[model samples]
Target: MNTTPLVQGYEVVIGFETHAQLCTRSKIFSRASTAFGAAPNTQACAVDLALPGTLPVMNHQAVVCAIRLGLALGARIAPVSVFARKNYFYPDLPKGYQISQFELPVVQGGVVEFFLGNEKKSVRLVRAHLEEDAGKSLHEDFFGQSGIDLNRAGTPLLEIVTEPDMRSSEEAVAYARELHKIVTWIGICDGNMQEGSFRCDANVSVRQPGQALGTRREIKNLNSFKFMQQAIDYEIRWQIAQIEDGHPIRQATVLFDPDSGETRAMRTKEDAADYRYFPDPDLPPLYISDQMVQEQRALMVELPRSMAARFVAQYGLPEYDAATLTQSQAMAAYFEAVAGGCGQPKLASNWIMGEFSRRLNADGIGVAQAPVAPAQLAALIARICDATISNNAARQVFDALWADPAGEVDAIIDAKGLRQMNDSSALEQIIDAVLAANADHVAQLRAGKDKAFHALVGQVMKASKGQANPQQARDLLRVKLQ
Candidate 1:
């Protein structure tokens, strides 16, 4: 019932189909290595290539991964499930049919919630089913012909299907990111978009208010968030224009050309009936016992939402701060370590979410690879809290610490001479000098001009080489004036 419109009269309806490549050492059906970047045909074995008389065997580790994801999303883990043969012919599909779940998926009916600028949004998941990946068709590497690389064939994939709940590209991207975090956080997948470990297909459509849903075009293999947003926005605009021009939108598969910044038709999308799905005769029904589910539950870590709530209650942080800190497990751990070390949860949250995140983004690294350790950041925050360094001086110290991650904070503070002037009598001398010098401004303050007092504070800070404690300087100036 959300009516957030993308154009003047049309609302965008979007859903996602995300593929998270499992981290098992071997293929889902075969014993072939699933490691990426192997030479063509080097990793594909007889079982992967569907040689005659070679039957597929399921990987137990893959099931464990599915269970972990289902538990994390609070989804129903079906005690029994079956695999179906998705009939499709493609150059990369060596078997001309993919082994996937259709009628009965392993996980079903979950909800993923995340924040979009302080407004929390939830998307309902249709199912997360296990499947085998098709191989790759290499087009860019050949001069006059395309080649098939079966290295990814039979690789395990968990396809997470979402209901059409997202109304904008922003929501879709946020949903994708949250799902990626869950998979990675639970150690099911590496969440490497570049290596194709995680990817999303967006089903985008434009509909008139209260009308039947429009036909959707599926944008495939959006591996980057920036590209995902651009593709969805461009597709929405294009579909709206088509409708405005009295053209009907066709349901098809499309590819996002990052260079052109537009989506182009790839092929006519195949419906379930067209694929001729049927239960696979080669593999039996998959069954999970009560004990298996219990074991997985024990292995599960606290979800991001639960952890964020705890942060709000225990650390007294705002909901936004809690959510931001819990974006990743490593980030949450770093924040906790800093907060616990310094005993200033709010300040720790501010610095970690602000300066720490900014620098990490600039350096093109994750929280795990940050140069400033939690202990080091905690030391810097402690210095600020104790009035040993002003806010600006702390920033200087932080920059030095980032540059030389092994450098002691106190050593850097002394080397840069950025310590705040906290001695009351010594600060009194500077305030008295400024008061004697700025007689006109002092007269303006006596006449009830607050700006004059601010000007005096600025002069006091400047005279002290920008090392005066801001709050302390303001308080001493007030007392002297009285």
Candidate 2:
């Protein structure tokens, strides 16, 4: 837990409630399509619109998504879970209630672990329940009246609730990012925050160390990480200032205005009892068989943590390098292929983390979209390792390779004349010629000025037109000095 305050005299406590829209093709309780950007109310069907004589039916895929999440987080998957109707009145909710899991959620009690700088932090999860999203209220395109968009109505969503274990916004963002990776990695959710595929709600409070928990206000619909952090920091400062001025901190729901960089109250926060949650009469209890869990387990891919550990143990990589490389599956696979192809794990790690990553970020693309192939990278590393090219020449070759991805690696080096001059006799001749011209430097080197020797090496490099093997030239210079 990060208990230290960004400002003095108060501790900021935070918890997150994230809603991840499942990747299923249909809504949770209806056959309506779950696609985005459709015309309003076009996708909503009879069940989604709560038409007369309609009863809710469970989508088995949503249940599988919840189960996969539980297994991924190491949570307890309830064999049988009840669905309930959370009574609430809003213009967007056609049924005036949301079908959700309340008392017996599908997943219970897990921890999400991630790194904040060098510190490893774990945030405990209270529960993750399956629910259906309500329609959208559009306040645009109508004069003095709002329109409702039912396209997103009844979309399958997994609402993940966390314990109030985060003490800072950074920690909360880390947890959200880690959870996003897990959901996307397992093919459950798209994890696109911009399109409302993944949404976050942060509950923020402040108190002195060892003091009783303070009243928390829930910041709703934080769709981006940057906005989430800004909202939490602003809310924490606001609450502390209120307390300092002897005003009570009221619990309410607030929204973050990205333009203003501030939070404003929307409504008073409601306790669970205020919602009147009870088992839905239409939907029966959700039951999961052991066989179904095993089936999903068989379909599960190797997780990032497990793959990172394998990278460390098998390739002799540092923990940090391994962890960084395994941020995405494509990057990890590319790294392994490059390392194995060249039989140089350390060099492969360096290039991937440094030049390749820099280029990826510059191009605003992921590793999967990288232009350079693993074999090409391996060949480039081989040249550098065998002294066929200097590090500078290797970078030139990398640029050439990236510019012309289909171009041959050796052809590029040969065409540019970037190969290092490795002939020992030729290098020694160059060194001797430079030494003969710079007698003062030689005398200064013999008189114990190490810098003069470096000056002589620079002359050798210049004479050879930057192609002289640096180590070979240095060795010849040292021998002549001796």
Candidate 3:
């Protein structure tokens, strides 16, 4: 088994606290818009501004979104849960206290399964609860003061906490990506890292196999997968180094510097006592009924694991290809669309994974924004399979189709006169011309030089203007040589 020295005599235990912003039109307690990038405080309302006499009104949409997520994670929705006030003093928190769940949360006890390398591993989830997000403090203009943006304040957030199950940074990142996919697939969250819809806080600690847990450090505000991996890797090594040097690990919050590629301590970790969490008197305890849970469960879609299996069994795709294609819902739908007709599954996968993905990356487009439509790509692949056009000609047609989605594949073939020269008589003429031109290669083929056959195929393809089907051209060349 591949193992890390950091966990050689010790077990590296990890848990994640992921905050996913709900896809709601307004803030959790106010009618203020929750849209991103609105000139800082333009989306803020009087309630979000923490004006006097403004009482918090819970958003039902936020509660439903949280319940949907809990059902998707296979968690138990509590009959009644209370929102507690987590008191803290920060410029971003205008209310001087943030509304969150303590002691009793809305949902509890679930598990998420993901693959580590080729092995399937399961991570237990402790709880997932509803909370309001704090505003952002922009430090861009440091004239000795920071700008406060309450646009994000009071936004509905679902804090999903996992049990200490991950061992390496790779596993942690994979788990996070899977969770991201689930949320986005269900339409609960947009999963936009750049806009901070989904944020991760990782708790990392190392312990001897049979010993108690070590001091765990919280790495906060990790937005991207690459940064998460790097930050955890660096933290693991730093902790290992500290233990090796006779220094004890400190429990604190740390921030990762992408440029420095290291994590630095931000503040001492706060205990529950520090937050002084207490049930809010303004709002009553939230309740979930069985009918509500059943309704949410009915809306859940087939998850990645189930879809992966279907891709393998029904589509006859390889395990890796199925896993990759099913990673994103858009990609999976695109694949199904392309493979809808009588197209060969393996060939469809090759074209989609190879040429399709290449073009997407080259053009800086996501699958959702791909210029080439599924039917257009499928028609192009059909033309190649039926020998109406060579693979190279089909690729050229695909490029044109990508540029112009309304452009028809058959129209492009007819317009460019790119049809494959598959007629036996026509191919024989080109084969004879090529053989006559390269007399030496023909001689080599007769002298048991099998490699010379490839040279002849190239010459014939060149003579036919790359229209001849390569396999047919080779067969015709072999017949003529014999």
lDDT of 1: 0.94
Error in Å for residue 399 of model 2: 0.9
Q: How would you encode candidate 2's per-residue C-alpha lDDT over 1-482 as one tens digit per residue?
A: 94475556887788989999999999999999999988889999999999999998899999999999999899999999999999999999999999999999999999887777767789899999999999999896557779899889899999999999998888888888888888998889989899999999999999988789899999999998899899998998899899999999999999999999999999999999999999999998999999999999999999877887899899999878887887777899999999999999989999999999999999999887899999999999999999988999999999999999998888998999988898888888888788889999988988989899889989998999889989988888889878
Global Cα RMSD, each model? 1.5, 2.0, 2.7
TM-scores for every candidate against the unseen true structure = 0.97, 0.95, 0.91
The digit string of per-residue lDDT tens for model 1 on 1-482 reads 75475576898999999999999999999999998887898999999999899999999999999999999998999999999999988999989999999999999989999999898889999999999999998886557778899999999999999999999998899999889888998999999999999989999999988898999999999999999999999999999999999999999999999999999999998899999999999999999998999998998898899999999999999999999999999999999999999999999999999999999999999998998999999999999999999999999999999999899999999999898988889999999999999999999999999899999999999999988999999999999999
- Model number with the top TM-score: 1
lDDT, residue 111, model 2: 83
Q: Report every candidate's CA lDDT.
A: 0.94, 0.91, 0.88
Q: Tens digits of per-residue lDDT for model 3 on 185-282?
A: 88899999989999999999988766788899999999999999999988888888889889999899999999999999999999999999999887
In model 3, how large is the Cα lDDT of residue 268?
Answer: 94
Which pairs, if any, clash in model 3? none
Clashes of 3: 0
Q: In candidate 2, which residue pairs get closer than 3 Å at backbone N, Cα or C atoms, i.e. clash?
A: none
Lowest lDDT 10-residue stretch of candidate 1: 1-10
Off by over 4 Å in 3: 1-11, 49-53, 115-121, 207-211, 442-449
What is the model-wide C-alpha lDDT for candidate 2? 0.91
